[model samples]
Target: MTASTANAQRFREFKMPDVGEGLTEAEILKWYVKPGDTVTDGQVVCEVETAKAAVELPIPYDGVVHELNFGEGVTVDVGTVIISVDTDPGAGPAAAPAAQQAPQQAAAAETEDAEPQGRQAVLVGYGAAPSSTKRRARKPQAAVPAQPEPASAALQAELNGRAAPAPAAAPAVTPAAPAAAPVAPVANGTGAGSAGRPLAKPPVRKLARDLGIDLAAIAPTGPDGIITREDVHAAAAPAAAPSPAVPAEATGPVSAPAAAPEPGLVDVAARERRVPVKGVRKATAQAMVHSAFTAPHVTEFITVDVTRTMKLVQELKQDPDMAGLRVNPLLLVAKAFLVAIKRHPEVNASWDEARQEIVYKDYVNLGIAAATPRGLIVPNIKDAGVKTLPRLAAELGELVATAREGKTSPAAMSGGTVTITNVGVFGVDTGTPILNPGESAILAFGAVKLQPWVHKGKVKARQVTTLALSFDHRLIDGELGSKLLADIAAVLERPKRLITWG
Candidate 1:
């Protein structure tokens, strides 16, 4: 069963790994290397987008990349071999195709029969997870020829009993067995049609709907004949070709159908752009849905005059202690929030639904909502209760910069007990921000605008802003929620409370 017998001497396979947090799969966002490219051990071969974040994957061993198993934009399973590297490139030319595949098959078989091994070699900062990445279960069923299927299709194959590898799909095939002749399987024999209902998961099905591509027409590269996002995209490319093909519509910008437009009908599909939901955006959507439904949320809004807080921000900017630091109203706002949390520590807690009890936390990992190119992510400033003003400002700057560049680690985004979302950055009045899952409260800081205010019993123009606090009603009631919001407003109104209340 050892691979060193023949082709194994030259070729070594690298499989996709669970990045962290029990992520089962990742999409091959981009490939940094190609076939015959020389690579060193620990060289980053490609970037992958998992449900949590975008992670760059490095090859665990040194070699020349013999082949790339999947194309870009394909979602691959955790244990699928992504790239095959020829470890002994110095030995002139490698073996034939059949010779190369034999050792790969043998090594794959060996892996299935092998015992649990050491921690998978992924990038640092991810915790060690239970690695049960065996592909043995699908050997008898899927038997794919090194093609990686979408993770969703793999899940369907696992739960819905084993399905046969579907026949190569026609670019214009439909589910009802229409007059369209099945085209030969394109690329990797993944899109061939079978004599049965086209097998595509709900999301892929929706993607087909959005693109106006028929599932039966796609060449499914997924295991057990599951159609994937790549297949849908592939089918769309040809459907837009100038050749006379029929029975399929398209919503993509490249779409050009054979038929003429109606006299007065607007082609809405032509103007629409459908981005498939996956990765960070997909994870964020699911988290928001879970939080919105599971947590009893109550949002309270307050308008506060923060003329003094704004003045203190300028004073702190010139102070020698605050020199070389990001001195802004947000720094004081965050500091005031921490001070308020210190006064009303109960706000920094969560509802343990399983235990039916309130869990009070002594330390606060404050979450800051950041919008990145990938999606909305809340990477937190850990242990903000203890960091000084300068230290807090430094960490906040690092966190924001990292998130904007899409380099924030998964560990940095977790373990938050409270959150602050500065909506004012977008120049809005205020908004009812949703609570981050598992966190009890979220404070929305609005834009500081100059408005007429009754100060010292007389109406005058003052720097005023609105604050909205959203809390878990199960733990923080109306009174506690009001007090927390009021305390934050009070500290902002009187900048000296940072010393007295803090």
Candidate 2:
């Protein structure tokens, strides 16, 4: 083969793109296709969990899968090549002569191993991977010795530089002891380890190590008989048995009482549970800390009768225009907040620290705080200020469902100009919610309760609820904050204002 032909790039490398805004890395949760599988453009090849959310990446070009640069559960940095595809599958047999097939094949393998060079344009949000293709030459393999014993067969295969065989089928004969179960070979064809390491992700291995549980000892329940996190935790829990015999010194009167065990050492299996904070939880934490410390927050609270708002919610539920849609107190409260923002647009803005400017947003990207199994996330409705009541309700419902399913995209959660967090769902009365990062304000809606109150010189029952508005003091002074809160209360108190003022 000519040097130019060998230098031609036959394989297309798919780098790990920045799936989310400013995200540096993502963990490869799963791979849809293995090496040699056919893939088409726009096919979701893998699922990745970034700091913001779990996203599925689609391949942009059709090709045959040549290699997966990284294994599942590995956190790969943005711009790093994760997979490669053979764009010209037929070129191998057509270009290489029969006599030089072996040499051509070896050279092709080296080319595949080299790092990709030059920027290949990818999908939006992903710029391009770094450019520099270079690889080290591999040393030649040693010859295998003849007639090796069964016990030393694996060793001899490694010495001969043969790839390790796939893990053997589950043994019919069980080990005499549970902890003596044999380890499986590495799944990706790497040579077997001397100690027979088990097939498990790095995180799972770390978990087993931290919990002091042996992976081989635990019965595997995962796919391909791999050990899972649950298996490790279960093994760590001691089986029920009789208590150990106490020393005679404990029974003696002069003996000092046994000191309490350290918190970590006492009932480690049942009493302690450790969960690593990553992905959404980690991002939320960092943003909250930055917002709390950087923004001087001032929260103001006021209690108002929302009976009219609740009645209007029921009316809207029965309205023909609102049929088949979700109508609740939140719907009206959100409308009220939007209207209030319309009245006080200054509250809907962000402080630009670098520019040393108070940037006011004319458009409203209203964020609604949601609590999902993963963590707290705030996804917003874009251009909510112009959306009709029905449109706003629909967007709110979709946003909520997506957040609950832990599928809220980074784009949906970003660009929020103002936010509303309803704490009433958990039966909480009120809370001083911190401002979401970049946004100037967050309105906390508390639980609405029926209470007695003086109305027009007569005692009457009313639906009373408290609203807490938290804002950045640098942008919103007390007077402006108070006016925005009062405007929201007035709209909820008199539901007709939605049509009149809005």
- For candidate 1, lDDT tens digit of each residue in 27-92? 889999989899998899999988777888889878788888777877877887788888887888
Flag regions of model 1 displaced more than 4 Å. Answer: 1-6, 94-234, 237-262
Residue-wise lDDT of candidate 2 within 1-502, one digit each (tens)? 7643552355677899997899998889899999999999999999998888778999987878877867787677799778877777876643322222333342243334343322221212322224345432244333222343443444333333443243354445433432322122111122112223444554567678767876654555664335667677776766633233433332223346568877777655567767777778888899999999999999999999999888888888999999878889999899999999999999888899999999988999999999887678899999999999999889899999888877789899889999999999888889999999999999999999999988789989999999999999999999999999999999999989999999
| Whole-model alpha-carbon lDDT for candidate 2 | 0.75
| Pairs in steric clash, model 2 | none
The lDDT of each candidate is: 0.76, 0.75
Q: Could you give me the TM-score of model 1 versus the true structure? A: 0.72
